[model samples]
Target: MSKFDDLPEARRRGLEKMEEVYGFDMSDGEGDFFRYTADHLFGDIWQRPGLSDRDRRLLLIGLLAGQGAADVLGIQVPAAHANGELDDDALREIVVFLSHYAGWPNGARLNSIVEETIAKARRS
Candidate 1:
């Protein structure tokens, strides 16, 4: 059977939200990390109504940049663009603005990832 076949409502919702946010199916994910990700992070935190998805994306982008989390940002940046939460110009502006606060080095890394992702998106 599939991992998600009999999941609780919250986890099920979380998986669906994960797919929506990341622009890919997450139903195949397994293990403790994936469970918590779906059950808490996506299910509870992401489901909060106070922030729009765009607002959350912006916050997450800044946090990820500040943390120098290029790998996660590699996923988030493209998903944000694909989900209409951020366009090319907005993504570029984020790199430019965050570079000041997040530090030039992290900003440089973000710039590279954003540029590469945008280019790849355009070519597809």
Candidate 2:
């Protein structure tokens, strides 16, 4: 059976987008949480109802910025791109949103990650 056979349509769409467009091959390259991220974060958890993919991306921006996770923000940035929830202007808007709670310093860090990720995604 296909991994998606019983899954919700949103999750199936998310998995396909990750594989075909974003080109992430899920694996335990970093061990532990990285593997958990690929499997649970994207695979299982995000499939839950109530929150749309757009809201997921927005929450990602908030949680990442709140935690000062600049490095992972690059990874999450591409997720919105893959899911069609983001564009250049939308990314800027996300940083603006984060600035309210996460502060300018956090927003700047998140923006730096977004910029780097945007450039890399455009290139590759």
Winning candidate number (TM-score)? 1
Global lDDT of model 1: 0.91
TM-score for every candidate vs. truth?
0.92, 0.66
- Cα lDDT tens digits, model 1, 1-124, are 4456588887888988898899987764679998889999998999998999899989999999999999999999999999988999999999999999999999999999999989999999
Instruction: Return the TM-score for candidate 1, rounded to 2 decimals.
Output: 0.92
Please, what are the lDDT tens digits per residue for candidate 2 over residues 1-124?
5465565554554555456434465322356765455456666677679987788778777998998887778777876776678887888788888888898999999888777767877898
Worst 10 residues of 2 by lDDT: 20-29
Candidate 1 pairs with clashing backbones: none
Best by lDDT: 1
- Local distance difference test scores for all models: 0.91, 0.71
Which regions of candidate 2 are displaced past 4 Å?
1-23, 28-43, 121-124
